[model samples]
Target: MIDRPRRLRATPAMRRLVSETRVHPAELVLPVFVREGATEPVPISSMPGVVQHSLDSLRAALVAAAEAGIGGVMLFGVPEHKDAIGSGATDPSSILNVATRVAAEEVGGALVVQTDLCLDEFTDHGHCGVLDPLGRVDNDATLDRYREMAVVQAASGSQLLGLSGMMDGQVAAVREALDDAGFTDTPILGYAAKYASAFYGPFREAVQSSLVGDRRTYQLDPANRREGAREIDLDVAEGADIVMVKPAMSYLDVLADAAASSPVPVWAYQVSGEYAMIEAAAAHGWIDRRRAVLESVLGIRRAGADAVLTYWATELAEWLR
Candidate 1:
């Protein structure tokens, strides 16, 4: 009615100038999985292009990611054995800790090295924490594990620790532990608005997770937007340096809310299911892979995420350049 649309859409240059949010190579973080006993990088069938890297291959990947100018890499470990306590998570010799050290050395300040501070990959039962006598997740016991994990991750040279277990008081516990251990400079990226979603299917396969049940008891329900904000507020008060929303595509509303109010950076995880869907659709010629990828990233940026954790972080950075 105002004849404004035509003026703004006049040309490509005009469109570029008017774009509200733009994606850069530095705004992406890659999620990498390293396994304890792999001879080579093992491919995950559920996630078409992702793999669990062996140590040698992981070093190469870190070099490439740093060369590509990615913001960081998030490390997850797949141990050969699991126990009730997920002892490997806090063990200095664990594959994840080893990988974190390797990444930090390989990148050498060229990129941020982040580690996942959750026990899902180490626990035999595949839950995020130790279980009670009745088999329910014991929140208090998990806090102890998290505290230990923070120290290990910081010692491993991780610039940031990702608290993805969705446990109460996790941020405060980890913060105190890190301070007490004299690793006060390491920051925590709290997964504040994580929700129980089907989008983590491929991720479970990537990590070889043995989860017996859903995470709804700890993860938030998608229907509650207000709860997402509350979680962010609590994490910020507990000394979280950054907050994240998981399964970003379906949870843009929550992401936007966190971005609007967060005093620190707001991040989003483009989980495996989201990546698989786009890759599957593109393989079948249902969508243009380049355009679709750019549009998806743009949508997340428009929702106000400062950075995105995506499987395509390296690839996208290359394409953009």
Candidate 2:
């Protein structure tokens, strides 16, 4: 008798029953941006449906995200002012910290409240770290700022601090700071293998970045896969509660390797460029939008990511439910 592998491919129910991977609402995280001093939401031209949300609008977004049943929301702040040292990052009254307090109050019980603990959004120079006398990023000095920023973010009620700066020894520094400040229960989400990629173009617009040069000096070279694995190992050793591989689709191999070896949860970020490409293509009627989005995220899940951060988190979660 001939083998009939097509039997499982014969129906939607059969495919669902035998599927090796699944994407769920609980495995999704939405990345949100809240702008300081904005009275209304400002639409990002590059990112079709996303916006720079005002404080009042942020509360509504958090409530909607909680209602959608996604795992959590990661908050990024767009401040009205910028400085050399990114003082806003460490200020208790900074937009990010204030948003954290608001999120904790609004949906703290319903969803995980995470914050982007990076200086790029707050710094006038737009580098992830403080610059040295020569104007190059100073990693050690940056750690000092991270330590101070960690305490403030934790005090502001951030459940998870996302260290996306790619600075050396950042996870350990922030972990020590949080513990020293009596926030021992707070978690660190290390952006372990963030690449300096062209895929971040739309993100620059979303955050209103003032970046003058590329982040190639700190961010990993997209050409090196082994470096990605090494970074994940270092972050894990440095006390990260979770590790992430960014620009998920292009770096699936790195993500899969981390997932295979990491002791902690492995997550992936479907970055702004990835989101924009699909959205733009769909707008042109080049592909079925819903199917593409689902498949893209499902591909990440199949590649061994425990969770995924995507702009479409709430909408995708609704579909998954």
Candidate 3:
């Protein structure tokens, strides 16, 4: 009884004094969706309070993110046009790139502006890469597209490119392309351990994902923990400035493994499904929304994420402040 643990829980001040982990505003990044040709913000049905922003709305969101003191904002584009090759992804005037420019201009000095460097949102078939003649996802060809995308995204003045395509040789390809294009200083935030998860259901709606069957051909299998680490290792070796383990709540082991081994910073994504679950429970009065949100993000940070990407970034930053 001499080493009673309850003693530390005796008061709020005592609990804070012995706290092992803390969440900070600077460690949170907001993921925002910007739609092409929309005059007004569009609400995502599955995700309450989240909106697909128009150009004006996106700028406002960037300003809010800067004011909230969040570390950065990640941009995803919902283009009005889609094609077989995902041509919009590499186009200079593409929605994602244009939005990146706007975000950078609005908050360049205040926060890091990151663009989603993937073709899934821009392609008609909903695949992350182009299809081969036999219909398989062409890994090598996709790396070529990614190489083009890196320069386009870099030209938009983005501080980081969120390489979420999960393609083979993607990091090296993009790094080489950027360096060759004189964008050697732009960092790459590789989605190293992204899993093909059921939890991505809400995300398909968020980006208007064009996926048909699944991203299993490229994304990591959810059951393989060691493979996730291997992906992180490969990415780091190929010059990824930061590595991420996605769907943070379900992949803490992977996140922890990456953080332990990575030479650079490790990040975790508190994905759409994770946010929706908490919101749904809170709406039904099953959980305290604020407390649950704080706990979920804090758990990610404690699991060894140097930073976290979450829909709740702005609100969480406010709460922490």
Candidate 4:
């Protein structure tokens, strides 16, 4: 057996028989970016095939993803204007809220509509939370905004609220707000182990973020592994229906830890910069694009993620099918 490693890899049929983790279309959730007031789908140069879609285009994209039988679509909004309080985030008429409504209606019961309940894309300061007098993210103050966001998202028909803001107590805050607002059935997907990562560079472009400073004040430092577990524990204790690890590839250790310990489903987000790097390499013919994409996703799956939120979700599912 020690000298016969090729036996399992000898043929496609053999490989299939021994495959421990198979990527399924229903296990992929596409992360989509929708910009307010966009005339057309604006291609993000850094992300090869990704675009900041107009609302109409967003509806179309969701329809396609739903038809492909993907699990869901995670929405990120690029508001036309952002403010100190990220007023647009809680506004029922905000582009993100409207897009939620449109996607929910367009997909009907075919897809699980989810929304990013974060202020980064809607805040002029480009932080996940509202700033305090010291210009630092005020965790408690931010909780209020998240509460409003929960109701708005629920009213707009979001089945899952992606609480990507890494502020303290966010899960409990949003959970209470949603329940208090009579949206008791809406689930909160807590971004429990979000790291302050260089991998978010392409995400800034995807969301057209106007960030001025770093998010190290709130987001976990990349070096701290134990803290990531603590964060996951806190989120789980605070009523998170599911927990997630962001920038999945580099944090597979954290992902594995979370998956091993989490009481609920554990998910991972294959962030934008990770997508861009593979795309860029493939563009220069350094790697086979299709193979690399599936491999990267498979690696995440192999790390124990129950589901993956990926920019390539729809395309990858279609290709696999």
Winner by lDDT: 2
Model 2 misplaced regions, further than 4 Å: none
Q: Provide the global lDDT of candidate 1 against the true structure.
A: 0.93
Models 1 onward score TM values of 0.98, 0.99, 0.99, 0.98
- The residue-by-residue lDDT of candidate 1 on 204-246, one tens digit each, is 9999898998888999998999999999999999999999999
Residue clash pairs of candidate 4: none
- Superior candidate under lDDT, 2 versus 3: 2
- Which pairs clash in model 1? none
Q: What C-alpha root-mean-square deviation, in Å, does candidate 3 show against the real structure?
A: 0.7
**Tens-digit lDDT string for candidate 2 (257-276):** 99999999999999999999
lDDT (Cα atoms) of all candidates against the true structure = 0.93, 0.95, 0.94, 0.93
lDDT (C-alpha) at residue 112 in model 4? 91
Q: Model 4, which residues run further than 4 Å from truth? A: 1-3
**Model 4: per-residue Cα lDDT over 1-321, one tens digit each:** 569888889999999999999999999999999899998999999998999999888878988898788999999988889899999998999999999999989995998999999999988989999999989899999999999989989999999999999999999999999889899999999999999999999889888889997999899999999999999999999999999999899999999999888899999999999999999999999999999999999999999999999989999999889
